[model samples]
Target: MQTAVGVFGGEGYKDGIEVPPLMVANAGQSDRPEISSLNCPPFVAVELCREHLGVHPCDRRRSINEYRSLFPAIDFSLIENDDDVLWKADTREKNEEVAARGLKFLSWLWTRKEKEIAIVTHSGFLYHTLSAFGSDCHPSVKDEICKHFANCELRSVVIIDRSMMGSDPATTNYPGKIPSGLDLPSDVADEKLPDEGKVN
Candidate 1:
């Protein structure tokens, strides 16, 4: 089976306010304007998988629950776990760790031979994780990634069969694709006070 992955950026945030309506608009669902974050809700993610990935209904619910449980608190925050050895590492080390983790995840998923696997994560996660695939890009591009991915934008990476390791034709890399989508609301965008000052 062939496997493909997609990475999407979170919603926008100015200061600490969240633009509720914009967030809904970006998800291609304007009727539900109550969404407060860019990370797709568990139900939505599961629906997407069912509709697009053709996962079984039971399997989709289980996957959604697993994902949601993995990150119980989904508000904006660093991805590193408290026990992660690279938590205190320097910038280079941190980036390397992120990339390693991303590759590892991909490798595991590829083993399943699923047709498509989508990862909805923050911009930093995507940038650092996928840095290994990017060549000769500007240094600033990495830094700007944190800002540019401020909105709920969808980006996809297609790894054709040829690109897989140990395949008949060893294709090392494929062009990373970033798709366009509407803007989402951010907690920071709709807030009047600074994020730090906001009461949880």
Candidate 2:
């Protein structure tokens, strides 16, 4: 008999955390029958898949998925955390207590299995988010990200998700759930949100 395990844990503070015995048994247990076609330092820079998630209302801010998209390959089943919605812009439904309204179709982008993804959004989102690239680069590079993208102007950029670069692929984010509500498509019920001590 043999076993293998991968723990993709991030820094966090929680009141109570527990592990199932089944997982404790797999500490050194990875024997993936198939090696991922992806190479070491996994990354995709070609043939991006253009995705459409329909449309939804929004008063835009850095979306919850924006944080995760920076590392899209981390399998979702292993993650466990809350949906941080405080940054919500008053751009859509006024229910600040509920962040799903702002997310609309955005969450779907993260679920797609394609390694190369193309996101289509307004200039405002591109302007602010691209700023995350930092201003220390070449003047033109800084100018491109900082400037409003003119109509039909296309720029090539690279995003890095360190998790996929050289880490074991079998890790997990624990009890994390996106949209914070299991029913992301329908109205998110308040109760479905994870209880503080139970899920954090």
Top of the candidates by TM-score: 1
| Candidate 1 residue spans exceeding 4 A from truth | 1-93, 136-148, 161-171, 174-200
Tell me the tens digit of each residue's lDDT in model 1 across 100-190: 7666655655665457656665455566655655243334433433343554566666655444434444323323332233122234334
- Each model's total of backbone clashes: 13, 12
* lDDT to native, each model: 0.38, 0.34
Clashes of 2: 12
Which residue window of length 10 is worst by lDDT in model 2? 45-54
Q: Which RMSD values do the candidates have, in order? A: 19.4, 23.3
lDDT of 2 by residue, 36-74 (tens): 212222222111111111224333223324423433332
Report the CA-based lDDT of candidate 1 relative to the real structure. Answer: 0.38
Q: Please give the distance, in angstroms, between residue 103's alpha carbon in candidate 2 and its true position after superposition.
A: 13
